[model samples]
Target: MNGPAQLADLLGMASVQRAGVALLVGSVGLPVIGVVIVGLDIIPVRFAMMHVALLGAAIGMLTGLDPALCGLVACAVAGAGISPLARTPESLSGAMGLLMSLAIAAALLVLSIAGVNASAAFSLLWGSILAVRVQDVLVLAALAVVVPALFWWRRRDLALLLHDRELALVSGVPVRRLTLVLLVLVAVAVAGGIRLTGALLVDALTLLPALAARRLGHSLTAIICWAIGIGITVNLIGFLVALALDLPPGPVLVLAAGAAALAAHLIPERRNTSWHASVH
Candidate 1:
């Protein structure tokens, strides 16, 4: 087959592959949003969650539980634990650092005791997008729907919290509750992305698009929409390219996102008179 034909054939893959691609698209959307507004705090949390995921996978292997589910639950629990600590800058850094270290050490210990292969224990570092199951797709679809809807419905409040939590609380915005909700959603998004892009590359789906969008958008809402668009575009392109080239999807997807970010950075910034007004 020629290049176009080969690409078409790749796109016209089996039902499972199609579902996996769809799952990737759905799984990536919300985390990119988190990356956009939640700021640098999310970076450490992402790292912590990855370590927690490894521990969860090791434990799952030992217990004969589904590793993916176990990893998701563990990440969610870590998010819950980190949420309160994340309220302040000092505590946030300390918490994520502590958790990341502890989780990785525990995971290594568990893997050793369980006699799990090191490569298998670290499988989440590479991911297997083409192997996603129908059940995983269903979960991704629900998350795709629910997360965006929640963000949309609570856009104003979320905006307030993102802008300044102290101000939001003073304005009676239930800061702690909202922060917890956001953290939980982040956990879910990170865990799902890990399954498709792996723990190491989840930022391709979450962070790069947000960074690219930051270059183009004058306001948070605009950035969010652009981030979601960029994320979905990069995901589809990356998946297709990986399929055609018979390469690892995780790294390919990350590189694609990086390319987009670089391209965005190359565009000269234009001053918008209305930016401040709109953002406020």
Candidate 2:
């Protein structure tokens, strides 16, 4: 999914870059989680994570939302009637919250109405890395391109809105429209990433790189570079280790991300560097 233009965009859009990193990590993280569960002698991680991932992916694709977004909506709305949208216009967020809640309710109702096998539905939640097909990779690649580019194309506004919605509004940043688009975008990216990593671990990919970037670098560009580098390392290494050891990839990827985060914390950061600009 990633190409030259998008790579260039990563130089600017921190959020999109962050999601790109998550994409890389989740692509491997889900399988790693499965391996960890197996190693710990817990229940078959595959069944739970796999089913959940599949269900989330299916729902997302069906609804034209990213599968990752679908899971977030379903889980979050099911738990609380919230949109997971903040740092933006409240009105737009409120609308998103309502829509997400309604959508999830519709999905659940459909599942209930169709009398679908709960077990089958669960597969979307947690998925199998061992069985990951080329199609999955292609889908992820496409999302990797679309997700990051979309955010990058609008990064300045997104940064302003997230860090300071009021200021952004006053500055003519289309706060309401931006908020709605961002809310939906976040949902979609999360849903797509979750397909590879599983919901439990997808957040790691989404959040970890940004967190690491906060500490290690000065410019947003530098941070994104580190974030993507960290993500790539985790995904590639985790997958290989899992394959060699006959382990699941999802939990392993999470562990890898965690380890990278810990290392970032422990490592000496660049001397005398400062955070260039706050999100606002």
Best by TM-score: 1
User: Candidate 2, residues 1-280: lDDT per residue as tens digits?
Assistant: 3355644654356543343444454443222222212222222222232333344545765566755445645543322322233343444335444554555556566566656555555566565554444545555565556545544576566555544556677878886565444334444444455556665666455555545554675643455456666667766677555544546667877787788778788978666333225321
Separate clash counts for every candidate = 0, 40
* Residue-level lDDT tens digits of model 1 in 1-280: 2377876766677853654555456635654545433453556677888888888889999899988788888888887877787667567668889999999999999999999897887886566677666766766777777766766777667666666666667878877787777777777777777777677787787778888887887766676778888888887887777767878777888899899989999999877433223543
The alpha-carbon deviation from the true structure for residue 154 of candidate 2, after best TM-score superposition, in angstroms, is 3.6
- State every prediction's TM-score relative to the real structure: 0.87, 0.61
* lDDT over C-alpha atoms for residue 83 of model 1: 77
RMSD of 1: 2.8
Q: Which regions in candidate 1 have their CA more than 4 angstroms from the true location?
A: 36-40, 270-280
Q: Tell me the TM-score of model 1.
A: 0.87
